[model samples]
Target: MASKYPRRQFLGQLAALGAAVTTVPQYARAMESTLFAPAGEKSFVPVMITPFTSDLKIDYKGLSALTDLYLASGAKGLFANCLSSEMYYLSDEERLELVKHVVKHVNHKVSVVATGSFGNNLTAQAEFAKKMHQTGVDGVILITSHFASREESDDVMMTNIDKFLALTEGIPLGTYECPSPYKRILTPATFKHLIDSKRFIYHKDTTLDQAKIKVKLDLCRGTGLQFYDAHAPNGVFSLQNGAKGLSCIAGNLYPEIFSWLCENVNNPARSADVSWIQEEITRLDDVIGNGYSLNARYVLNKRGLNLQVVNRASKSPLTAEQIKISDDVYKTVLQWHERLGIKV
Candidate 1:
């Protein structure tokens, strides 16, 4: 007899292993050796922010501290060199170095995946992905916009992805519907095509539509692919519907809360708590993204992460109104910790 909870069972085996990261090629010994919570057991994977010094340089010290903070807050994996990290502002060399630094600092405690597709063409993107893979990340994520422009059709995007796969054969890859350039959400048919390819092991979904999310999750039923929804409002819905975990910008603010939500979203005993957190998550979603990673950095600093509010992506500093809003949200976050007995 088969289990009624098909998705759970499909992911359960890897969850039992506790730290099974992405299923990469045998040659990727670094990733293979790293530990990550499988899709069955939900985990938080933060779209990590880049910490900069007063001089606008990549602050390695702050970066290390930020890395430690995420792990301490229960992040099971790290999505470095991403939009949250201001990847577009960083040079190619900076991107690779940033990812390499994160991989070295993580020391295989958990898997790390970074954006590698920054080139203008499929071949350049493939070459960059290969180099990023060499940096010991478990997976290299390709930005969807980098494949095809907004003017292009899904078929054009698919063909380019196929070419990319061929060019960077044998490497573990993932896809990010990055909001930059443009957000090219994959249709169900296109999603099935990627699933059929079996080359992608992760997807950071920005589709934000619950119905679409459900369809995508259905496609991931028994595949090695794990879908991570980036929308904060869909936290409970996505988790309950079979998403592996979250990869939202909100995690950059309260990773512990996100991690807590993931661990308990499916707990029958905590169903009410789950619902309440979902409400809170939905309510604060806009406020959190107002000033974005900068607002997040401010909150993190108040929480004792000691990060400077410096940012290259959103060069403008937070407005007084934004700061006031973030401060209010920060107070609410503390209240949540106290109310739910989550660690401060």
Candidate 2:
């Protein structure tokens, strides 16, 4: 025989279950909080730097001109000292000088973000973040540790964030999560801890797994993390999955394509017109041998940017046949762009 329960007890149990179920949306909202635009805020679309060589050195003049093009093209922001810019190859002084150049050229027309990912030195990275803040740049983009073990990588990330937040006090920071076997993926719990701290203002979700990406979104909900999709090939799908914008290498060679996608993402009538554009961009990635960073540089060269396609200064170099393949792919993409009336 079951014991009799009062109506109040039944109601209390119902309320608890309802609260648990209702928390899902609340959690999602919390995770997504950081990504929201401020009141009356306009959308921002960021373009990456395409490091070009002039006389076998970094081309400051060409860099300035390219930045001016993006500004004139109505880009909302620019990122300096990134993989596209070959930041890893640059010395500390070169990186600082490049940031100064980027800020000077943009001339406050748009936000300028600089990469601050130094290898395995939280103190150095934090100090760099502080300097970038002092330089009056808008933000800093940081990568987690360079450890091969996941546990070690996680420890480095947690420690780095603590130090970075303490050092960079008032400035916004964007963390780039590009998963490699050497680095740890920021788990949902760790992401929540960071987001809840209210120190990190943006995140670039470059992890390839759709499920993991969703988890990122859910974990960061309500934390005011402006999430950007770094995987250029899936920009549209990423936007659909709650990413506020994109920060990508493909944006270097094909700003118009990304510009169109961002503009038409919310407009149903215009979406089909741009879906083809997205598809073409994705196809271009495949044609150039996907996942090779040099592909973007090659595409830019083919577009007559006069940028060198050399990635020798990078962490790795592409083979001669790889370069030929990249160039051939860019030509094909250009022909497709012409056919589609997409002006480069």
Candidate 3:
């Protein structure tokens, strides 16, 4: 028999995983009063969707148009060529061109980063990262080392990271626990090594386990490494627990909601307000996504940007079932947005 709590996993209630309580951190409140407060707004960096023409080539103009929409819609940061962008299907040249284009188009309007590393060849990967850094992005993030076997020793993973880091020269680095080919949730020891490097500056923790997330957030504090929990359900709870910001796929559709959470994380008075917003976010995700990329395209279409959801690596154009969900969820989110008085 299936579990009754369909939404529990999505909402971060995975108590079986030994997750601890996620609460507001006093350190975050105190940081605001200090001079060395982390620069940049606590913002959501949407893993942006890639637009495709009828023939599947990059829609350069369409991409620029999307940038305008994101900037206007309250996105303070943009993540490019991530799994959300179908990085697996894109060629190296295409990824570089896409990043360069986004950097120029965004033009310092917000922080920009991309998943620059792809395969196991650390030399080429580092070269690509170096090039991406020159494109004016704030950082280059490596997808977690999924190439290694599950039985692969921690030392091998650490050595791979060290090799990759040595080659990335002047680029600021971050890691995304992207469960793509597979997910390798970083051990606390690996996270500590990153903090000690003084070079790895951001982490998109994907474990979604509240206890471990708290541990990661605590480790990141004052070390200048920003920990952004990638799982949406934990977003609000994690924010209150000293997470520096949020980076999630859901931001592609609902940046305004995430941006609001980041800004108001410290206000205990908004507890009721934030809880409702977060619930809406997760509930909408439950209905609107099998994976966010295609769903995002449909919503963008519903919002009036037309593009084919033509993806070679996965489902494209969405299923009939998904489109039905899209219609219902779209209407619901609009109503919720109005009720919440949200602008985007």
Estimate, for each residue in 144-191, the C-alpha lDDT of model 2 and write its tens digit: 433123556566667657766776665566676644323346788778
**Highest lDDT: which candidate?**
1
Looking at model 2, residue 318 earns an lDDT score of 64
**Across residues 1-344, which tens digit of lDDT does each residue of candidate 3 receive?**
11111100001111343257664322232223221123645767778778888788888888998888877767677888787777777777788888889988876666687887765467767777777776766667877754255689778878877888776654567788887766889888988987887767668888978998888888888775777777889988788888777878777666667777887767687778788888888776666557457777777777777767665456446778877877777787687678667876
lDDT of 2 at 167: 62
| Candidate 3, poorest ten consecutive residues by summed lDDT | 2-11
Badly placed stretches (over 4 Å) of model 1 are 1-35
Q: Candidate 2 lDDT (Cα, whole model)?
A: 0.61
2 or 3, which is superior by lDDT? 3
Q: How much does each candidate deviate from the true structure in C-alpha RMSD?
A: 8.4, 14.4, 11.4
Best to worst by lDDT, what's the order? 1, 3, 2
What would the TM-scores of all predictions be? 0.90, 0.76, 0.85
Error of 1 at 209 (Å): 1.0
Error of 2 at 219 (Å): 3.6
Off by more than 4 A, model 2: 1-47, 50-55, 146-156, 179-181, 289-298, 301-304, 311-344
